[model samples]
Target chain A: MSHSVDTWIMALLTLCVFSFLYRDNPFYRFAEHLFVGAAAGYLLAVQYQNVLVPNMIRPLGRGNLLPLVPLALGIMLLGRLAEKTSSASRWALAFYVGIYSGIAVPAYMQAQIFAQLADATKPWQPGWGAINSALILIGFLTVLAYFFFSAPHRGLHGASARVGIWFLMVAFGASFGYTVMARVSLLIARVQFLLRDWLGVLPGA
Target chain B: MDEALDVRWFDPNRINLLVGLSLFILFLFVNLRRARRAPSGLYIRTLPALQALDEAIGRATEMGRPVLYLPGLGDMSEVGTLAAVTISSRVARRVADMGCGLLVPCYDPVVAVLIDSATREAYTQAGRLDSYRSGTVQYVAAAQFAYVAAVTGLMLRERPAANVYMGSWYAESLFLAETGNETGAIQIAGCDQVTQLPFFVCSCDYTLLGEELYAASAYLGREPVQLATITAQDWAKILAAIVVVAAVVATFFGYTDIDKLLKTS
Candidate 1:
């Protein structure tokens, strides 16, 4: 009995969320506010448990001083919301930027440029590796040629980027198809609700 | 009447089932009244979103301004990036033809290069190969706020007449939209961020909601088969909703055997 009642209450909550689609009625507004409050409350609780307690309060309580670094950094991030003290936030920003840039800039060059171009170039080695590599190289070169912006398009760079146009077209086409699948899946999930869950009719029925 | 059993209301599956059924019913009404088209037939239609390039480019030409297009925050895995590229292809062609400037600031380097190519190729395709600007498409830092700052700086420096935003967006959606708004540009935006839809609606002149972003090329390109697929997907939605409602009803009212039989089949 309780199981079914629980199902009903959950249904009611979900229905409240979906109600927004019909021009934001009172029920939908209620649901939206409830959701916002719940989300905020949950975030506060999680941050307290995960970051504050373990990373800050616990350390200070246990006489561990090293945790103060992260504790101070976290506090500085809050300075961004304040007007006068916002300049102090830059120290945190610069710290993050330095660490992030250190990791990202090199990773991008090595991964996107060096690795992709290398793999694209070394197509004809010895075995199937040669075949796949050749294909990748051809595709990359053609696409690169299609976008060749630096030099005038009188010769090979011009021709390669033109081939790049075809590769780009194919990529866009595949992306389009996949996007449709995703949209259809969401629509299907919603529609399935109305059918099996609400009406309770199916193959067996 | 056991309180312990009452706590079962928080069960994820039970909640999901009820919620699903409710939404399915709601969409049934939402889709039923709109238009009547055959399921299998194809219809080609044009949306002004494509013409937006012509307008944006024409404005840039008239005002001697640049056009700024940002491919959202996500990398290539995002559908928004692909949509932005397709739109950029058209915009680049127009900008090339009009002899106006184009600026594309991208979050992802891979996507930036691709967008740059798409922009350059648009010029090449338009026979304005000489007009294709190498500096037109460039990468900004990948961090969310850093990318936003970089894009905002470009908008301020260039002072574009028209801003086009297409792709996956999150927290930075409003930041970009609001910045574009401040610049007094005619902003045309499309995104799949359901949470950010309201922001776009409030800030942008033309906003594509939810699945509309995915249907952009088809609507803008006026492709018949693509339109047909869109219709099929709509019908598929109806079919899915009916199934959900049925599942919920079976799961309720002590019809466990019926639900099991339906599931097995």
Candidate 2:
């Protein structure tokens, strides 16, 4: 067994969380609440040190006025706390949304649309590659058809859209399988930590 | 031979992108004008998940249990969060109209404020301002698993009849969904996160996949400008498809011009 106090506390919390698999209980609730409260406190401290201190406080202390713009915007965001000043928060929200949208639109167009189209339109090699290329083209077109809201799915469009659904389901299945494997790996890691690090039962430990 | 690297203020290679964006704007403007002239003539296909939203809320109202909504763990910068906020506004409005209890637990403080504002507006719009509760939208935690823990705890304790999750999600999607499932809540989840879609699909009653999440506001709002945006997006997709086909055809014929033209860098 581990003699370290931190290890003991962590191992117990892990067990408390695992208890939820059987059913929700006081131990699990205690662990959950503790984690949430600790996390919220930790986040506040980290943000103060990492973000507010360096970006706003330190800069202002150094007589840099540029940071004041963002600082003012942030304060305005806090105006939502009171009903009388709540509408004032919209200016900050609008600025944030507008800047983000302007940046995202061009980036999305370039990366998602243009880059993807460029790759999809690349020349195929020979033989089997050509067949794979054809499949890609068909899948792309059919999926696009499925997402076409303006057009009603009927006849040829409906068939293509149906095929698109099949493609989507296959994708979802593959993703689900991949994610399950990842979760299993995580579970194995936790089990290893419990057995080796805590109990010192594993060969290396 | 020595050659100088031609560097300019702007890369000419991205001209194609500029042209495409211009066309998109043109389509949006034209569609907006058309939609304003005749909003009723436009047709948008029914999204089953969005359609089920009302049904989910109604079930919660009938069961006399609060409807829980979690706008996933994303800040305002994310488009998914914005879309989620829009849908949450609609949900709040409906909940107010039906005189049902509503709960919205938030991950981001900024998003909490946004949701609080939206919910208050929704209640006011529905003439149920008195029903608006101060603590309806609460900021739980910034950490992902911590937020999930708080939310799952709430779900178990409150036993909300309908659980609505919208926006960007991560690994906690399943944790939230499965816990809600255990509580026997009618779950309707929508997200743009590709990896979390399967979890929602398996656990929730209805799942909005990919672009469907983005389209929900436009579909539900049915306002002329919003519907026009949907139509414009369709047109943009059509244009992209045409370009892809043209480039492929051109490439098949040993002409690499179209391919090179589309390249970003």
Candidate 3:
């Protein structure tokens, strides 16, 4: 076993989290609560030091009037604490939503829609690559048809949509398999830490 | 002067995007006016997950168990989070009308505030403001895994009958869904995150894939303007498909001008 106190604490906490797989128990609960509390507290501290201090407080302190706008919005967000002032919070929410939507609308259009369409339209390579390109175009068109909510799915549109559903399901299946592999890797890492770091029993250790 | 140093006020490369956006807004305005004039003519296909919202709340009410809602891991700036909150408002209104308990644990503090306000407003609209509990919405941990752990713990302890998850999700999607599944709750999950949809589809009773989550607000609200926006989006997609096919045909004929025009930088 490791002689270091920190290492022992880390191992025990790791085991406590792992204990959740068996069932919820006191050890797991203790670790969970500790993690939650520490995370929240750490987040508050970090936000205060890194975000509020640098972005808001320091700017305002330096006589920059620009930070006042966000400060006012932040204060308005706090209006939810009371019944009478709660409606004022909507303004802050509206401002936030408007800003984000304005920023995202053009970005999404450029990146997702136009850029993707441009790439898809590029000339196909020779031989087998042309077939692959054709398949991609078909998939893109079918999926687009499937997502066409304005039109009723009937006849040719319905057939294309059915093909689109198959494409979506196959994509989802591949993604699921890939993610499951990632999760298994995470588990292996935890096991490796237990054996190699804590007990010093692994080959490298 | 060098061409590189000739900085203009606007980027010519993004003209296509500007034109596209302008066309979309024109469609939106035209549709909105039309829908306002004749609201009854609009048709929207049924979304199974949205249709189940009432059933989920009813089940929770019948079982005398609270309904748990997680508004995702995103803050207010995310469109997914905004849509989730809008749907949550409708859910809250229904839960209030049915006299069932509602619990919303939030990842972002700002989102928690917004949800809390929205829920209260929903209660007011339902004429059940007296039944509204201040503790219905809460700020959980800001950290992702910590928030998941807390929610899973709540799921086990409360054993809520219905779990509604919406908004932008990450790895915690499976953790939350699987835990709710274990508790035998009827779970409804919706997210725009492509990678996380598979996990939700596997675990949840109903999953809203991609744009369905965005469309939930319009579907639930049934407002002319919102529905008009959906129609406008469909028109934009149709236009995009046409452009794609035309560009492909043009490139195949050795005419690369269309492809170059569409390129953004």
Candidate 4:
């Protein structure tokens, strides 16, 4: 109930986790198991409280027969834990997979492929933005051409795909540069932590 | 200002200083008295493995086989992806030197483009201006398994001598490693994802685990600022650990009042 006790408890737990860094000793092992156990227990409690009782049983009790479908699905999902009824879990898995695939496939197609093409093709009207747009179009067409698998390597589409390949190459190169900066930042963050907080020799601290 | 800093239960300033100092002293002692000799590259203030990366490429070139570089499954926003790309720059340099073709398969569009630039820059820097081919780097599907299938196909088709997998990965870690193994390529992998390490360790020749993935840039001497940051983070971890032990011992001995005071203070 007390915030101070809670804080100390958290600090102890954190220390247990950090203990692993000093060569995987018993303290780290104990902490790791404790964390796994606590997490599983908490998840179980939350599921029962949040999902099963309110969404299924309560609705059934209120005479909404429509709740039977969800109730059945919920029970079927629990089949995963029982060897005898494990086959029933397949339906639940299928339902989940179907929903996920339905949402993801279309979303990815629209975002990564078509949208990129649209952005790549906007005609420039003799301004800086237009010039950039034209450059982007050239890059996209050449890069896309390079990736072309179905069409012959002789026509305008082939030529555009080649250009798309070029754009893609440049894009990947820029991405590589940005990635260098990001990784370097993480290393910098960690070093700063050690020097400023751990060693106290770093002047900026 | 003095009174404002003197809150007992929740004094951020004092707690920060105490935690900072405690960790600093611990590591200072450890580093000073360390008698255990680690693997030559692992214990150093600066990384030595990075230097050998060029050698890996040279060997690949002598063998007359393509080099396979995987930028991982995530976007450039991921720390692991960034490390992979940074390492890729070095690898690209070596590949250009050898005039060996470099094949980079990307799972993210943004990352795909970034790697393309890095490949070109490395080639240009090596004075292989005309050698930079756009087709060498390509984007596979963003779907994890689809990306895996495409990469596996490339691995089979190219039969690269050296395989480098770096960045954020998930279920496909084993798939890529096992495929690379089948081709008998010298595979080096690095990932910050702890769950994927066991797979990489089992499958790859050299595996960089956890924080090591983040340290790649520093290891390669990319920036001095990164070295400073890592030192600071390590200090924070050590200080936090000591406070934890003290709290536990205090609680066990029924010094609940003292623990409470410390926590609240």
- Candidate 2 per-residue lDDT, tens place, A1-205, comes to 8898988999999999999888878999999999999998899999999999999999999999999999889889988878788787999988987887787788878987888888877876688888988888888999889988887899898999999988887888999999999999999999999999899999666
Scored by TM against the true chain B, the candidates give 0.74, 0.93, 0.94, 0.74
lDDT of 4 at A146: 42
Better of 1 and 2 by lDDT: 2
For model 1, residues A70-143, the per-residue Cα lDDT tens digits are 66875785674565876676576557545654555334334433343323322144566657645655675455
- Candidate 3: lDDT over CA atoms? 0.88
- Give the Å error, residue B88, model 2: 0.9
Residue-by-residue lDDT tens digits, candidate 4, B1-265: 4446543665462453354345555654553333223222122243334555666677789899888899888764466776787778878887887898789878775566557667777899999969888678776666665566567666766789889888888878876898789889888888877566667767787776555666666556434444443444345333333444454455456543432323212
Encode model 4's per-residue lDDT on A82-196: one tens digit a residue: 6588678668656754565455533443444334433332334355765675565445445434433323556786677556645544554564456547657965876565555
Q: Which one is best on lDDT?
A: 2
Assess candidate 4 and give its lDDT: 0.62
List ranges where model 4 is wrong by over 4 Å: A1-205, B1-52, B253-265
Candidate 1 or 3, higher lDDT?
A: 3
Find the candidate with the highest TM-score and give its number: 2
State chain A's TM-score for model 2: 0.95
Fnat for model 1 comes to 0.00
Off by over 4 Å in 1: A1-205, B1-41, B44-53, B223-225, B245-265
Clashing pairs in 2: none
lDDT of 1 by residue, B1-265 (tens): 7456444435443343344445544544443333234422344333455556577779888999988887788765555666777777877877787888888888776577567657766888889988776677876665665566556656766789999888888877877888788889989888866556566766788876545565666555544444544444454344443443444354345443432222210
Instruction: Give the whole-model CA lDDT for all candidates, comma-separated.
Output: 0.62, 0.90, 0.88, 0.62
